[model samples]
Target: MAIAWYIMYRKKRFDRSHDTEKVCPRADNHPIRINGSDSSTVLSDSNQSRDSPRTSEWSNMPQWLEGLRRKRVASACGIPKYSYKELQKATWNFTTNIGEGAFGPVYKAQITTGQTVAVKVLATDSKQGALEFLTEVLLLGRLHHRNLVNLMGYCAERGLHMLVYVYMSNGSLASHLYNEKHEPLTWNLRVQIALDVARGLEYLHYGAVPPVVHRDIKSSNILLDHFMKARVADFGISRQEKSALHSSSDIKGTFGYVDPEYISTSIFTKKSDVYSFGVLLFELMSGNNAQKNLMEYVEFVALGVEDNEGWEEIADPRLEGKFDVQQLNFMGGLAYNCVNPVSRKRPSMREIVLALSEIRKPRNSETYRVITEETTFELDLQGTFDSSLTER
Candidate 1:
């Protein structure tokens, strides 16, 4: 029986690889014997040795055997087994839909153990499937940081794939910035959020073993918790670093956030992530969506640098002169560096984190006053505009 099992396993592997017996002579080799007994006899003895009814007794054994084997292997690796019904119950029948993206809809759920989690259920016809689910679980599960979302567990049963992550109560950074109902985030908070996001990206690019590139880094993908702490989420396009300096792939990322260099060359690198990060920083500083006014802002800033006019005039008016000019200028410099048309000119993630961190530290009294005055002037300008213009 053991010999039969060995033969079957070898044949399965060979067939899966499309390798024929004529090309591989070793495929005909018989299973080796153990002690004095034949290998086939040992497998027979072991099959019957179990007290429970033998799996072979079932008529549908062959059809179900592979799935059973896969489940056993998954279990050995500490992956949890969850039924669709269990997930449905935890999600209140999928009633609480909090968010949705390229993968699918995310629901706020409470596990039977009473822990709140965000359940990402893959769409029935999602273009991304088990490969993405496995990547996120394996990558995000092992990563632990205040700035990166935590993966609790996952379910892959009956072709229904889902990822379970810690609940982020405040939704996404994009929502907070663009949603009018939510209170405006202070400029300081926005700076801090940028710093947090930079740190997370730095960790993914340099801190992890083999490192990871978060191919998708945008406001909508950055979630905020109850305290408004930013945590990087969504890993559908993430890829592990290889020994080679260049990675090749077809263009894959959100339109406004995709790296121009990568798009042009079809080669991705850490700088690709930096480019996306720059776009996110621009969004935070300008309070504008990348898809909306970023291109115009980029053109304006380019013209400002060429024409020698200070670029500070383009700062977000909604801030009402409440932000520091030096800080804003520093952030703009970083954003400019990040969005550099030449990918090699972009600052590394480490440099980005360090630069943002420096800005967050308290400045000297003179610098503080300068920032305050600039902020006041902005507020005054906005007030003047509001008074002069009719309501739209």
Candidate 2:
């Protein structure tokens, strides 16, 4: 397969990215390190969260949690802790079931304070349940960004592990893409979604204190708020920069979106997340499923990295020719670089954010021309530039 970049293991000298976090490639893969960095104050902007519900008597228990009522466990991250009985009632007996994840069921609810939240109730039988629960609670509580979902609170009692999250009214990006009942996403909106998701990943890879890698980043995992703004959710499978444990313990991710090299080597890095993001670009562009490897199905189409006609075949016909040729070419071109078989060839999430932001500007402007330099095609894994990129 043609690959542009090869994975390079080296430290970057940027200011925000320090040795303390110790992240690289898919660096967010380990448990929270017990260091001074873990206690860095939560971003002040994230403090807008409304007051939590008042504590109440414990109920719906096996008589065990009752003894530990006054002695509740404190989240190491200092996030709000909710009682199991409180969450159960907030979710109205878990009746407003919204969705499901790797560990359990998610329900829509109104907490005692009248604030809306989505509660994910961990399944009793999932072996990975505890790990995923802790991962999200610890990671999200400390990491905050406009593109990342906000974790309102959490509940751990009576053999139950549940998390409370701010509700997104619009729902997952997948619902609008694959489901017919929802309205089609316009080109600008699609570009915005891509940009938003990229920003979230950029924050995880660069902005977070200990850069994180969202192991699973697909359309289904991306939620759009009422304003159509995207938020990267589901940190259950996420890892911190220092944790390389996934390479030996588990191979996680949606099948079609998994990085090819990662599958071969069983090593996931931040670039692995980039590989998945590439598939996300394809989904936004073509309105197709990546689960069946649609990227491969249209590989020839992307090979024409500069051929407008070849890319037209790749874009979602749903736009009805309303999309800009330059934007499509630039985005499709970027996506091509992202899924490069070699992880190093994939553009970093930071690079992706800048590229997408550039796409939002006027096509006739100097910035548009500047994007050309950034979009220049890199050679494949064999170190040879593929000429088929121009072939229709």
Candidate 3:
């Protein structure tokens, strides 16, 4: 989004004159490239270069108070701050409740700039505290990718905090999977969504300077935009690692998707995220809720066969034999490896992306061309791993 000035509060009143800036245009549909520069590291006082975007005043903010005013102001500079009344008006007195999250209820609103957005209000009793809120703002401000949802603006006043995000017309992948109102997702579309998520995770793990661990990865957290393209959302529990091998004792994640190793040892790493992704893949394949009987059925079907042979039994019965047999077998094997008991045995996101690309390739050149045209992505299905893999 285009930059907006800070919300300077005075006598409990907000000066909202500078809230006119609109979010940047939506990402274009093209074959994206996956490269290190696709992501940016959170700027710290020590990392500011001469050409850095920070102003002198911002750079000179009190370093000792990193936990206080400095961190808030510095990370919040480019993001627009909306007043409570403005967001209330946008959300029609918060009556437009579309869904509820762990943090709070979500509302669909159209901001003054004519941009439709989703407003996530922080519930008073939310387990996600102020620190987690700040972490979400900081991470979304710095990290930008097509697969990641865009944060439009925020509200912090009147003892309340809320985040504004570009609204996704199709809602969540979870809804599409299990909701009877919506038609079942086609086999090709599911594969495309899986690739979208894998590329996003790849960016967080390897592309970002200081890698990020999503901490929470579930079907509900994966949203689809107007074109049915997927984006990874909800970063309240995410953490940035100083190095690739970062671990946290706090075990935070959804019940079905949580890594067994992370729960057992209380150690969370990138592989923990991979474990979660594996669960998500299975959900995509089976069109079943992870928390319900999905895993149980998978384990049962898995025990009856060797490797990926019998995974077709677990495939969504709705598909009704429409998916490619070879691809399903390959994806089953790949997803199985991802949820491996030993974290180290799981394939990295980078590897998963490449494997998915292969699995997603069409059997013939004509079909490949037609599919690429529909998605507007120039994917090179020949395994070259060209610039398209890194193009953002």
Best by lDDT: 3
lDDT by residue (1-392, candidate 2, tens digit) is: 12322222222334333422221112233222222221112211211222212121112122222322334334334567888889878877888988876668889999888988899888888655566776776677677677888898887677687888889999999999988998889999999999889878877776554466898899988998989999989888787644643465467878889888888888888898998998999899999998876977668665654423456577787788889876776777678778888776666675667667778887663223222222443332222333233111
- Scored by lDDT, model 2 comes in at 0.69
Candidate with better TM-score, 1 vs 3: 3
lDDT per residue (tens digit) for residues 334-374 in model 1: 67767778876566676566556667777652221111111
- TM-scores for the candidates: 0.73, 0.76, 0.75
Q: What is the lDDT ranking, best to worst?
A: 3, 2, 1
Residue range with the least summed lDDT across 10 consecutive positions in model 2: 52-61
Candidate 3 overall lDDT versus native: 0.70
TM-score-best of 2 and 3: 2
Superposed on all Cα atoms, the candidates' RMSDs to the truth, in angstroms, are: 16.4, 14.8, 10.3
- lDDT tens digits, residues 77-181, model 3? 366778789999999999999999898999999998898999999999999877666667666766767889988877767768799999999999999999999
Error of 3 at 264 (Å): 1.6
